[model samples]
Target: MGVKAWLSKPLAAYVHKKQQHWIQHPVEAQKAIFDKIIRKAAGTKFGREHHFDKIKTHADFVKAVPVRDYEGLASYFELVQQGVKDVLWPGKPIYLAKTSGTTSGAKYIPITKDSIPNHINGAKNALLAYIHETGNAGFLDGKLIFLSGSPELEEVGGIPTGRLSGIVNHHVPGYLRTNQMPSYETNCIEDWEVKLDQIIEETIDENMTLISGIPPWVQMYFDKLIRQTGKPIKDIFPNYSLFVYGGVNFEPYRKRLRESMGRCIPSIETFPASEGFFAYQNEQQDKSLLLLLDTGIFYEFIPVDEYFNENPTRLTIGEVQIGVNYALIISSNAGLWAYSIGDTIRFTSIKPYKILVSGRIKHFISAFGEHVIGEEVEQAMDRTMAKYQSAELIEFTVAPYVSQDQGQSYHEWLVEFSRPPHDLGDFEKDLNMQMQQINTYYNDLITGNVLQNLKISVLPMGTFRSYMKSQGKLGGQNKVPRLSNDRQLADGLLAITSS
Candidate 1:
């Protein structure tokens, strides 16, 4: 074994011991974090506004601070941008993670010195957990690639600002620097397609062992590798053993990814976001993520059904139940208090606190009150495609198709297939039936005549990619919404195919 892998074994053990303490004492861990952050921020502007010092319990917290999305915190963010100190947190943030996709456009999320360790260590511990479990630190000896955004930073309020992935790139450990791939110049290329080509050239013959990225962008890399070398990814990089991914469910892309790799390999799923690093799949066998209770953040959940209500019930970690969809809220070291990050999740196990990201609060389809979520659509598609082994899926999305002249409105599926199915009608029937089986409300809508059966619209190959590129969202954490309540995305897809 190489020095790094040999050294990781002991470090992994120590990290695992720490992880076990929090897992066994989840509530206490969260309570400690809650008290620390609240006490520390009590003197800040937001702390004074919400009377954080006066609050002593979760109930008091709910009563004192209301949950808000990025837009709701705009005024405080503006003050911070104007170089105000102690407005949201104790002082100015060391950096701001700039992201897009919110209705208000770009959001500048603070990352304080106290909070930076959570983002960095969350990822570090995840890998260490793997090493501790399987004794597979051999990946440390080979090249590791992270297909990420440009690390270039611009100024926001005199603080360095960039994409979260880019910001994390700056913090890559000194030890791992030699194993990281695609030299700095290639990573900074402005266009994703151009950057991808350069990455292919740089790592095509390297001893790659680990690959990390959002699934779609990684798929693009795999595709380019196959075209360039005319070999399966496994054959191209025989040492590749670990795949780490986040931002979307992996089930829909699992089959294609496995096909590209020529075999299944161990994988890890993480629940990291610009707001906080919340969870990671700690076990090789268990797909669910263990919520990081000891991280410098406290979590709250509001039932999805009650999310839009005037006053919703907010539950602490101890109050959450398995299988119930909840809009995730967090109070983190980054100075975000009672902040709704717009994502929804469900607990799979409460014994040690495991969760699956169910969907986004704003990214659901309730156009006809059916209330379908991202998880359901992804699962339905997964099941349907599993039966059609010969066909290959590229990308897909669903939106409600409202008829203008009083005809029945229905759900429309726009899918891009790299390898078309033998029988398109049968494929559509299976997909519709799968949706009906997974979502009773969608089934009811069709059966009750409120909506017709869902229709499949086979988009030409590359249509989705073209549309995303046109919108300047072709890569780096941008994903096509799996479920949209309206027809805007659908119309955009159709326009691209037609043009």
Candidate 2:
């Protein structure tokens, strides 16, 4: 057997066994993980402030540390910025994974000595799990390209700061470096467009077998490759059998990516947040990813239907039901105590726990009492575009139009279409209909003229990409918010397109 295969075989088997054990004893596994995290941070200020000394169970932990959003935990993180030891995590964090998705300005998530290995090992274990189940170990022998952030590390008050992907790239296994693409020097190039050009130039002749990236940016890269080479992606990477993706929904991009490849290559979805590496796709048959119960993270779920409630029920793995949309809360070694990651997810399985990210907690539109979320908008757009087959939704954002000049407040859908819909008016009608059918509040608003039918504005191509680039969040762990409560995205998109 090849050295790679021989090495991976035992690791794969171990992962398989561990996952099965997790399935059989999920409660035990999670409790163990939670306790371990508590012990690790027991001496930290956050832990002491929350009375971690006496916090015995999940309920105690919840009672001690109320659920927090990024803003809620901002004070503790501020202390970490000044190189405070044991403020959140163990010692001062080794790095901060910077983000701008939900909050304004920049949010720096702590990456401690304890949490760093979890991030790196999650990706490694995910690969081992995939290979164990599908016998795809040979991909490790060939070139694998992780279209990551600029490997150029920076400093924020003595702590290293960079994108999560870039931070993880520094810890990539020495052996895998032999087959990984985009040389470290090229990776250190900061400009995304310039970096893309170099990545294309470097990988043009490589024997690539695996690639990992978020959907939209990777799609942009693939489109550029096709445009340059005048060939499908399959022709470029004939053995590219694995595409590991996360940070965005893949369903809408899936059809487009598949069409470009001219063949179906298996994919693995992951739910890796900057706070922690939470979940990874383990099984092949199901779309949901298995929650990594053994990680140094404690998970609690509050039903999205009741998330805004004064006293929403928090359920552990032992109490959670399948198919319910739940907002996830995490307490981790990184010192985030019961922090809401903002993303909402639904469980597909209870035993061992498999979940698919459903939406974001904050990115919802409810201007006219027609509460619509990220998943709803994306699904409706995907379905509407699929009905015509000629149209493709590259990117979109929706906002409410409640201006006095615009009679009857309604939704304004700013969509960037790769191929213009066969009938733009009809496509808008179908999309509006889809939205109304799923959400009765929306349907009632339309019926009573409380809100007019949703409006559609065909955006100029490359508008979303341009906006992202301008915002300096063009690639790696960044995404465009689909549904905004205000006109931030809508106004910004309009300005970008017009200019």
Candidate 3:
């Protein structure tokens, strides 16, 4: 083995040991890491005057650094765009993970060497959970197929830029690296169509043991595979063992995927973003368990009302309460102090701190004049699916549509189904009924003349993939956004709602 390869395993082992030790003794871990980071930040002028001055205790660190959205990261983004150093961090970042923001066109997030370990550890924890759950470590020994974005670092105004998938690809261990279908950097083609076709062709004849990527892209590829081969995915490659994905909820996509695969493939959910990989599903897989990476970030949460406004009370991991939804606030090693990524989550438990992703704070329908959070939508959908003999949803998107005349507003849903419901009208009615039943407030808004209507439209088979592809958004990190709040974006999507 080469020097780097020889050194990697031992280095990984050492880091893994430290992680286990820290997990067992979190109090000591927090104090040591917190003091070190404080000292490091305090030693610098900007850190002392701007950062350290705001933080008195861990609690103060949570509160004083006001929760900020992507727009709040604009100044840091401007510095990176200009190729200036130390705008957010102390030194030049090793790489930047490019992702599309909801309102801010495209976001370029810097990741330093110190921050990379968080992603690595998060992935390791996922694998460990798989091992513990399945009792099969060797299940992951074969070639793994990662349906990731192209590794080509495009120059955004003369600075190197690549997607989060590409950056993570570049850092994978060499042993597994050689076994990957697409080599990092070379596999990601700039052309979206060509890349999809190439990815489909590559996986056709391979004995892919493990598959990983966003659900929509995976569904898209499989849809193409079925069409091309005239056979189901199980017949195409029966050797598949695991499905690893993140960037969106898998619950909506699970039923259809299970039917497509012909059986259950041990699926794993990872909570990752351009900023950092925050959490992963532990062995039980009841909910995503937050594996606190104290070395990389100090985390906090802020509760939001059904109206989508942020509440004043902020809670740390130590202070998080069970069964309450809170928007995530993060202060990371890369120098984002008290930043809100806009994603909301609810804790399933507190002793070990298991969390379920609620939805994005910005992706809800309030302009329609009725408050609808992700939880309410998810519960309603779950109940609807349950009534319809377990018909699984492949992908779906929700938006509020207003009539041109002055009248009550209505919600229009575009959903893709894996298995056709026995009765389409019945399925639609059941879904709308469940929506009213689950959230009485929403029902009151609808019945008491607050909102005019609610409508659910079933899209033609394969319409979701075509829509995503047309937008240049078909692949690993991109998702079929659950709620499209912007009127323009919503109208554009509605235009192709598939009659």
Candidate 4:
């Protein structure tokens, strides 16, 4: 073995063992993190405001800090933006992660010195865990491409501010920097399409081994590569062995991605956010991610069913159950206290605390009392697409559509298909059946005549891409929502298609 591979093997083993220690003693790890962060932040402005000093247990912590979304914490965040010290965490944050918000125009999440390690180390350990598990570290020698935001930062209150991925770009370790691809200049282009073309020009002939990005963006790169070279990605880069992705369910894009690459390869799914790194897939066979209990973040769970309750029941790691969807809340070293990031996750294993990203708390459809989630729709699409080998889906979204004339309602699936099935009617029927089987509420609505069978609106290829571009959300860390509760997105999509 080469020097890199030889050195990586022992390091991977050490990280793997360390990961197992936390995995074995999850409750203790979490409690330790909880105590450390709470005590550390007790002197900060938010800590004093919330009575963090008296918090002795989970119950006390819950009673002291109410669960809050970004809007709810706007006052504290505003203070931080005004160059205030000791506002949230002890002293000022090192960076601010500027993220696109829905109702709130833009959100600036703090990234303190202590909390930045969680984001960096979480990604590093995932790769090390993969190396340890698969006994394959050869990819470390070849070039790897991480499709991310620009590393360029703008100052906010004397602190650097940018997208989470962009902020992470500045922290790529020295060892990996040698193998990273797409020159720094190419990465800083503000226009995604221009950046993509430059990236293709820069690395089209290089020894590309691992490609990492959100699924859709990677798919875009692959498609453009094919168009430019008239060859599959496998032909262009034979050493490409691993795909690391997050931000969306991989199931829906699995078949298409495989076809683009001309074969299947190993993939790792991660659960990360601007809030903190929560989990990463440890087992190759299992798609579920192992929760990182020892990260600088303490987790809390509110059962999705009770999330809207005036006073929801808050549960710690010990109180959670497998398969129950919970709105993920966090109190982190970054000084976020009882903050709700709006994502929901379901535990798959309790022994090691494995989890699946079920959906977003705000991204669901319950128009007729049939609460269909992102996971359910994505699963239904996966199964339905699996039945048709000739079909290829680019992207899709689900929303409630009610006919004004007939007063009849149904779920509308706006699908952009690169290769449509031969029989549209049959595809629609199979998709509807799949949804009914997965979600009983949807089944009941259809059977009870409260709603009709879901309809598939065939959209041209690049429809969703064009829509995202028009909305100024074309690239890094942006994804089309799989499910929306209302028809706003549906109407907007149709309008774009028509124009």
lDDT of each: 0.91, 0.85, 0.71, 0.92
lDDT tens digits, residues 1-499, model 4?
Answer: 5677778999999988777788898889999999999899899888898898899899999888999999999999999988899988999999999999978999999999999999999998999889999999888899999999988999989999999998998999888898898889988998999999999998899999999999999999999999999999999999999999999899889889999999888899998888899899988999899899998999999999999998999999999999999999998998898999999999999998999999999999997888899999999999999899999998999999876634378899999999999999999999999999999999988888888889999998888988899899998889899989988888889999899
Better of 1 and 3 by TM-score: 1
Clashes of 1: 0
Return the clash pairs for model 1, or none.
none
What is the Cα-based TM-score of model 3? 0.89
Weakest 10 consecutive residues of candidate 4 by summed lDDT: 401-410
lDDT comparing candidate 3 with the true structure: 0.71
What candidate 4 gets wrong by more than 4 Å, as runs, is 404-407
Model 4 clashing residue pairs (backbone): none
**For each candidate, C-alpha RMSD in Å?**
1.0, 1.8, 3.8, 1.1
Candidate 3 regions with alpha-carbon error over 4 angstroms: 1-21, 24-32, 43-54, 59-64, 155-159, 183-186, 306-311, 390-392, 403-407, 418-420, 497-499
lDDT of 1 by residue, 57-156 (tens): 9989999999999999999998987779999998899989988845888889999999999999999999999999999999999999998898999998
Question: TM-scores of the models, in the given order?
Answer: 0.98, 0.96, 0.89, 0.98
Best by lDDT: 4
Better of 3 and 4 by lDDT: 4
**Which pairs of residues have clashing backbones in candidate 3?**
150-188
For candidate 2, lDDT tens digit of each residue in 50-123?
88889898878768888878898889988888788889878898999887745657889998877787899889
